[model samples]
Target: MNKTLLGSIYLALASSIWGGMYVVVKIVVSVIPPLELVWMRYLVAMVSLLVVSFITRQKWRIHKRDLLIIIAIGIIGNTISIVAQETGTMLSSAQMGAIITSSTPAFMVIFARLILQERLTLKKGFSICLATIGVLLIVGADQVDLSSKLGGISLLVAALTWALMSVLVKRVPSEYSQIMVTTYSILVALIVLTPFVLPRLQAINISQLSHPAIWGGLLYLGIVSTAGGFLLWNRGLQMLNASSGGLFFFFQPVVGTLLGWLILGENIGLTFWTGSIFILIGVILVIKEKK
Candidate 1:
């Protein structure tokens, strides 16, 4: 099988996991504050990845010049971007948030074209448009009001930061192990989040930690979503051009809708299915693109 094909699969898998992750995060955040939850997520993810690194006998050393780059990536991609996203969602409706996040692929495509000299093929352009429309339909964007300017702008920042991070991942030296990079980047994020999460952590009692649901959610967010998901996503980005890799992010909303239907008893209307078909077709078009 082609490496690019395999990379696309990895990206799709990671995005699908994240689609369900939003659902889990919603439930978890009901019991934990968003910033604190993210902090714990980074902490757990860093440790888990470190364990994996040790088990795999991966080198922990990194080039000095790359240190600042990884730190910047951590701040932009994980900490600040996540904070902005949470703030935007808090101030806006879910529909609006989804619609805004759907633009990330477009930002990534643009960035890859400008920075990496990636070609913006006609087929890729059409696929992005089709996917964006599908997302808007699925998210019921017609109902969203742009009146919440702060929320809208925050989401825009989040989207741009995420796109920048995706491109930056491609800039990492190919000789470096992606898992090591992931672990280090997450550690950097955790360090930056420590002060913010500490005050919140002090309020939690040991009894709260004993709750199975709390522990379960944390583990899922940290181990599965953060550790496993980032590893796969970075690996995929390493394998493919940032523009092509960005298209797989479209899988998030599709899987989210399906999970809602299955787990939350959410209605799956005709429009929803139709939009899903469009998204899938768009994804397929990108996946089939040859290097």
Candidate 2:
């Protein structure tokens, strides 16, 4: 298969898993605080990915010069991004969180052009506009008032952190395998989160462990959404440029919105359809542009 096609497939799979993550997180958050859940999810992801790395014999070494950069990626990209996302979800409705998080791709494009010195194309410019419109429609202009100031700000931070992670991942040395980068990133995130883990642990209800839903959600989040999704996303990034890879995020909101409706029985009204069309059109234009 073509590399682009493969990248698209990987991104699609990642997006679908991410879309369902909102619902899973909602269920888990009822039983566990967001901070504790975030730590546990990363811990589970770290262990699972480490096992895979060991079995696959993926190289674990990094160049001395690149060590700092990798560490920064781990802290800023993985740790901060996850924390921001979880905090944002806790502050807002799942659908609202998903919609706000969808802005990450647009922010990625902007950052790539400014930081990576990548040239922008008309298609990408168009995509930014369309995605903005879609977000507005998805959230409904009138419902904007529903957002608390702190929640809106938190979600914005989540979008920025997510975008930063995408940019930082692009800077990973070519010599390091994507799997290696992902594994180490998660490990670093686990370490960074250790300080907060104990406090959250105190709040944990041991009785909840017996509840299948809690365990199921944690397993799904750890194994599928965090580990599997990140691996696929990193693979897609390796195959595609930052801008192109970022464009794939456009599909996330659409997938997430549909899942929200189908699985959660959320309303799907005219605004969703209208805004989604604009976002889709914009994403197509962005992908068609040449690097």
Candidate 3:
């Protein structure tokens, strides 16, 4: 019932959901372009969020001053960062994408320090090091392609922007419902992406909708990954400090690897288990920290 513990649960659930999302994306993305798929996911999430808001009788109104931060969060994290992440993945290998983007928590620590003035305790610092090592071991640095200069740079942009957006979640007045913030922020992303996504809509085979997997996959992605995932992640950040809260982002790879092995029958070896242990230690360290 402690705030940190509850927040940790929220963050973990969000990241784990995202980890599983990769499998779904792998299936659905073949039927849909990444950006188009993202646009559809947001549209689904938008409707779902609105329905929840209406049910909860949550106020849609937000302070005028906070509007800027909300828009910034939308543009930075939801739109640009995601687009770049997809672009990077397309240009580079999964190993490279996994390795590059796992630095998000470390970047979150720095942003939290500079923007929110959160102190970097030795424990938090050490935990990040541990998690980063775990990611490298799991992702396998040997498979990374040095030739993917643009892809590498794009992924770094994704990491940096997402880290900044996560920290910015702390800046929105705590009085506002994170649900409202998340919903409206996603709406902003939809608006921004609409112009780009609309034209491509014609290209997609409407016939693809007849396939159960494609339709079902988008529904899960929108409802679970975008709506549920973003809400839990933002709500978690409300209760926990950005620096420490960011540690949960590491759960994505761990859960992803596990689900990959379980669902996709992906091969795993000693390094996967070893990396998971390190990641667990990193998250457990912060959860135990009082401050």
Candidate 4:
């Protein structure tokens, strides 16, 4: 298949994996706290990536000049954004969290313009606007609670930082393969989070850790969701223009909402389907623009 086709497929699968991850996360969090889960997930991701690097024969060396950018990506993207997202979800309802997190693509377009100097043409602008509205509809803006101000703010922070990280990934030297970048950045993030996660580790249920379900969830989140999902996402972003790639992120909420209904028994309404149509239109516009 062509690179574009492959990239699109990879991105779609990545989003689906992440969407399904919410169900797994919901189960795991009942046994493990969010902060501890973040550390555990990344730790598994880091080890899994190392195995991938070995198999792929990826270079591990980083240029002296590139070291700082790598570190920043690790801290901002992995550590801060994830912790904030988890905190936000804990503070707010599922609907509100999903809607706020869906706002990432909008911020991504804005950051791409400012940081990467990517031109925001009329088509791109319209696409972003359409997708943002679709996201709000998909999650039902009417369901949002204004009372959870702190949670709302935290989710916004998660969205912005994640956007910044995506743009920054493009700025990294091509000398480092996406695998190398992911591995090293995750390593850095693991180191930074260790101090905090270490304290929380004490509370973990050692007997529960041995359960197949718990380990299964950890492996899925760490290896599949973190390692596989991110690799596909970053690779797709590398292949497509940032503004256009941002549009594909709309797939996250679509898959997420569908999974919520099928797996969690959440109700789906007319607004959700209407929103899905708009999101699909936005996705089509970007794909056509790319062609």
Best by TM-score: 3
In model 3, which range of ten residues has the least summed lDDT? 85-94
lDDT of 2 by residue, 150-176 (tens): 766787887887787888777887789
lDDT of 3 by residue, 181-291 (tens): 989889899999999999899999899877999999999999999999999999999989999999899888888888878887989899998998898999999999996
Cα RMSD of predicted structure 1: 1.8
Each model's TM-score?
0.93, 0.92, 0.96, 0.94
Better-scoring candidate (TM-score), 1 or 3: 3
CA RMSD of all predictions:
1.8, 1.9, 1.3, 1.7
Number of residue pairs clashing in candidate 1, backbone atoms closer than 3 angstroms, sequence gap of 3 or more or interchain: 0
What is the C-alpha lDDT profile of model 1 across 1-291, one tens digit per residue? 889788988999999888877777766766677788788888888889878888999987788988887888899898888777766766676667778888899999988988899999998989888888888778787778788888888888888898999998988888789898888788778888887788778776657766887889889999999999998999999888898788888888888888888988988788888888888888888778888
* Winner by lDDT between candidate 4 and candidate 2: 4
lDDT of each: 0.84, 0.78, 0.90, 0.84
lDDT of 3 at 244: 94
lDDT of 2 at 180: 85
lDDT of 2: 0.78
Candidate 3 global lDDT: 0.90
